[model samples]
Target: MKNKTVAFIMAGRRQRRRRWILVTSFLALLACALCCAMLLLGSTIYPIQDVVRALSGENIKGVSFALNTIRLPRMLAGLFAGFAFGLAGNTFQTMLRNPLANPNVIGITSGSSAAAVFCIIILHTSNAVVSIASVVAGLATVTIIYLLSRAKPFSVGRLILIGIGMQAMLNAVISYLLLVGAEQDIPTAFRWLSGSLNGSQMHELPALVISVLIGTPIIVMLGKHLSVLELGEQSAASLGVNTDLTRMVLILSSVCMIAIATATTGPIAFVAFLSGPIAKRLVGVGFSNAIPAGLVGVNLVMAADLVGQFAFEVRFPVGIITGILGAPYLIFLLIRMNRKGNL
Candidate 1:
């Protein structure tokens, strides 16, 4: 009986692992397709041959300029930024064991947004300065949230509440800045606030790309520990996980990735908030869903961008489309959580 049970458990594990691999693979392929669509389906559609030739440094007139100058950077911005948001959001949700604990809900992105807006309006700084300020502010915001939540007995609920409060405060500051700013600067600030890919350029992608590349490995390497951490502090410690160090590392890596992505693309809405749950639902429960989550984010951003670009008579920002999609899901989630008494 014991041997039979062990064999059954092993078989189940194998099946789950296979399922995870298949699901993650499918998501990766979908993301790739969306990226291709981003590059190919713009105002003036370019054939795959033209895109390929243009990518390979061939100057094919209009195709070269459009593919290299515009579409490539736009696709890359959505790709890396989406990955960063998805991965970081999943890390937060998993570590905190709450759907509401993602950076979007917790004020991290708001912190970045407020700093970026301040730089745009009041300081009139360059994009580099704005990016730096936003990244610093995001780190500082998370640190503040963590410190405030670390009372006599730490509580995830307390942390989330504090984060929400911080988001509200930061948002109010943003509103005040906008209200008092010169009218000329308001449009610029609003464009950034709306989270666009309109002016994406190759020059602005390095920091974000680097952050995602480095942070993703760190997060994925710590995936097992993250899963264990989800079991609570005492349980994780008992299981030989250094919960504090692990949690701190995870938070830092995730914040850096998401912050840099925000600096790059201006908080492309709900990619962070929705990626984890979608990946989790798709990939099921056997293996770490970090990669799948990132892929899902890429698909969401790219697909939404495509939709925003062509779906309506007017061109909409990618963030607007994501907001429209995410808001409904957020409402449904809240209602469900409330019903389950988990809200």
Candidate 2:
């Protein structure tokens, strides 16, 4: 009884620490800093007061135009899309029980990208149509992947392996489309593929914002069930978790947000892949890391964009930098998983 009391007190202290909340707050603050930097430190520096004034509908000559039109939209795009990528990516990683089981690895982004590329190169469709097609394609791809992975008793490893194969095939399709695309259309396709924020406008921001806002809450509310699901089907069901309903809701919500984000920012490389692990590592276990993961996603996309803009002689897309950061990690993860006989 004394030992039990001591352990209980220690556990209470750890819970009171509430380190997850503090970490989440820090990430939010950092994301805000990056957003402010993106706004103020563009071609010309604007004072904080002027930025505030411009944001509040005051029409300063040059500062207002730049802030309200260009910088604001770009910053918003990165912010919303990053959150979506992070939330969706972590959802997949947690559900599938594998870090490599993200949208990027599982061909969800490729499905959206492929559909968008086809619209740009072949159909010559409007951006709205492209966005619609991308969303539809993403949903279809996941459905197909899920069905294929459901053969017999269900295997997470089989699902991931199948996703990797699908990703490879989709990548090949993207390369072929790029090759056969018209010369003049090639640049547009390439830019979209590279996941750039150049010329981001207010019109493109709504879909991403709305989807993320709606989906994030649903995921957070279902987070408890989601954590249960991570314990596997038998255990989760034994705990009275509605495995199918919870999974369907989580998958649909995550895929919708991810598709909209991919449409907006061109997948942004591994923002989804890296955010969850980093969040899990920081926040430790026995706590929901969804919000922290999303915040980490925001920081990565914003910071990577800034680095791509100023860290080198030539401007690179945000995806390129993230890809550089994620590839090494992917290799390390693969080796580690193989050694553990998980691959």
Best by lDDT: 1
* lDDT, candidate 2, 47-141, per-residue tens: 99999999999999999889878899999999999999999999999987788889999899999999999999999999889889999999999
Give lDDT for model 2.
0.91
Alpha carbon lDDT of each predicted model:
0.93, 0.91
Highest TM-score against the true fold, candidate:
1
- In model 2, the clashing pairs are none
Give the Cα error of residue 170 in candidate 1, in Å: 0.3
lDDT of 1 by residue, 1-343 (tens): 9999999999999999999989988988888889899889887988899889989998899999888789999999999998999999999999999999999999999999999999999999999999999999999999999999988556899999999999999999999999999999999999898888888999999999999999999999999999998899889989999887999999999999999999988988888989999999988897999999999898899889999999999999999999998999989989999999997
Among all windows of 10 consecutive residues in model 1, the one with the lowest summed lDDT is 148-157
Root mean square deviation (Cα) for candidate 1: 1.0
Model 1: how far residue 26 lies from native, Å: 0.7
**C-alpha RMSD for every candidate:** 1.0, 1.5
In order of appearance, the predictions have TM-scores of 0.98, 0.96
